[model samples]
Target: MSDETMRWAPAVPAANHPGGALRRWASGWWSVVHLVLHPLALALHVTALVLLVTGTALVPVLGIGFLLLVPARLLVAAGAHLERYRLAAVLGVHVPASGPCPVTGAWWRQLVLDPRPWRRAGHLALVSTFGVIGAGVVLALAGTGLAALAAPAVSAGLGHAGEYSWPFGIPGTLHAPALLVAAAGVLLLALTPPVARAFTAVEVLTARALLGPGRGEREAVLRRRVETLTETRSRTVDSVEAERRRIERDLHDGPQQRLVSLAMQLGMAKRALDRGGPDAAREFLDAASSSASAAISDMRHVARGIHPPVLTDRGLDAAVSALAAASPVPVDVEVLLPAGGRPSPTAEAIAYFCVSEALTNTAKHARASRAVVQLWHEAAPGAGLLRLRVSDDGVGGAAPAGGSVADGGSGLRGLGDRLAAVDGWLHLDSPPGGPTVLEAAVPWTVGGDR
Candidate 1:
């Protein structure tokens, strides 16, 4: 699995193991004695697990009981609070203190009102039950060790009383069985932390599910999203302005000045027409008119290329229609939109030009039979969500650098930069051998202050 998949995998605690060779040897033999003690430890774990699961699962049932014991609700509430804290420590969960569950009139009524209180209550009750089991196991292990110390004396005919040689009337002459039991008890105590941590993890998960944050937190998240989108909008405007300046410079120096010189020559030719004969004047006039017309046409095309009038007046669907008609290849378009859901003018312009550029690339390079264009107002799961996309189908392996922007000589790099300025993104997916798709998404509301 990929890293993302692994990141969301569930937690599993590791089992405790001996740290060194002496400990390992002790543990190997300890296991033999532990067999005598395993049942008790196992019983503790099983009992605790069952209680924890049952109490949490039957929260609803206990909620009903709270209604009848309204007076003792404090005690019940206290017990739940302790369990929550203890569970946090045992399970090693780092959860915020939610404080006590509020007191409601009639314990049973309160329990019925909220399932969580009872669920937590149930878990606490189970923890208490498991606490008993764990204590019993410890006691059993201790008892076995104490009895083993006395066994030697009892076997020697001194009786159990004669074995009392140390503090608390306990014997310290370690025998095989007694030593083994003591070692096993130490191991069990050491393993408790891991067992507790597992339970704590479960509690953390349960609390997260049951006591999720309120509406205010959700609104705060939404606000952050808006803030991020606003920042994107500002960047988009800056990028667009930069692009405009670049295009203006390109035209002013290259086409615009050339057109101006062409107009001057045409004017001179017109003056010469007055002095020359009718035939010569006619040819000069024709050439002058041709040059003037060519320059005028070039300027007009440039102005239209800068920002198409169709896009401003007709919106994305209509503008894309105009582009489709102009494309060299047959293009099919499908658009579904609300009647009044017009994208902001800038977004519409960007989208129209983007589709225009993409389709132009497809027609010029992708050796495909047909192309499809789709436009729509799509909303994601949250509020304030609106987006548009354009896609195409043609020969695969088309990329901005390889075909569209590079070979076609359009500043598509500027187009991508413009989209980015608005917090929008452009995606191109094409693999060699036959179908290429391009997509772009931008916010509906204007991104920047422009």
Candidate 2:
């Protein structure tokens, strides 16, 4: 059998077996209870809908009618919500709730524009028809079953000879007639559960069709998600290209030039040695060595910017602390990573770079006397998120868009794009005064051991 079929397969033996059949029959009877109650519940919904329709119609004539719109919409939504739950609990079918209506603009306009209310109204109208029919069928079956079951007592009370006719012309008299009637009653009772379940299945199908967000809504949601992802991807690519250019420029201006100078100095030192001037040779050699050392230092700084070793060795907590200590402004650092809970290396790297970039902006642009860095891991049920907050008491009005790195916009924008690459985000709250606060968060999965 397929996985789905196997999942729903009964644990008990086949229904042909006596005990299994009895169990099945018992379950069927239990389902009858829900069917009996269904119509009464539907009746209340129908009455409420009738009143709502009347009130809505009177809206232009009476201002009071406008006041009823909100409550009426809510009442309809409530009925649909209850029906969804009822279908799940009683019929073993789940129908998801509709997406929320737009709450902006006038309430009446919102109600009129929303498709859910009208959909629910139509559903209730159909349900009312179904309920009336279902109620009549159930009452007929139940009344016939009871009459058959008590035929002897009922006939005796009415002063008639006990007689029963079942299956067309098959007639019985006296005690035999009573037994036959009672058997018919037992059969009807046994059939009730399956009958009720069949009716409930139809109702659930109706509810699923009308009460949930339809296909158009789902498509719109998907389209919005696609657009958002596309924009993010574009920004990420731009940020990466900018970063690569910055790296190339840094290498050419700093380490690459130092290495070239060191080579020139080595060539000069070789010539001095050939000319047999020991002091001159030694001076050239020292200068060359100093140049080489400077080049190495510059390369190390570049490599650190790419991925800091401190972040890998000591986790985000220690890394952020080090960053704060090195800041031009006195920075207060608070790190709250769980003892054994550290984020994945990629996540940690992204977070570290984000903070590093933010601090760079704060120090260079924000002429702040003090700053604060807060880093912590928030553990939720199924996942954890790493949160970083950087605030500076500086000349504010900082934003993630507009201006260059020198003026402090590209850096923040780059940080945002970088965070986006790792499913992280950056939020900057800097009004045109002082105290700029930059907050960032990224999904974190606990790394093994460290």
Using Cα atoms with residue i matched to residue i, what is each candidate's TM-score against the true structure? Answer: 0.45, 0.59
Per-model C-alpha RMSD: 22.2, 11.4
Q: Over all chains combined, what TM-score does candidate 2 have? A: 0.59
Per-residue lDDT tens digits for candidate 1, residues 227-346, read: 876865775576668768877986886577767777776676667766675655676567666766776776766777788887766667887898889888888898876675566677
Candidate 2 local lDDT, 1-450, one digit each (tens): 664465466666567776887676566554566567667677568766976787678788856666666777777877777777766676556677777774468877776667788889777776778855765676667778887788667766776565544456666666777777789997776666667667666777788889877777778778987887888789889988998999999899999999999999999999999897877799999999999999999998888877888887877888888888888889998888777656778778878887888889888888999999888887543466888889999988785333233344787778777676556777887767677888888878534212
**lDDT of each candidate versus the true structure:** 0.57, 0.76
Model 2 alpha-carbon miss at residue 186, Å: 31
Q: After TM-score superposition, what is the CA distance of residue 229 in candidate 2 from its true location, in Å?
A: 2.0
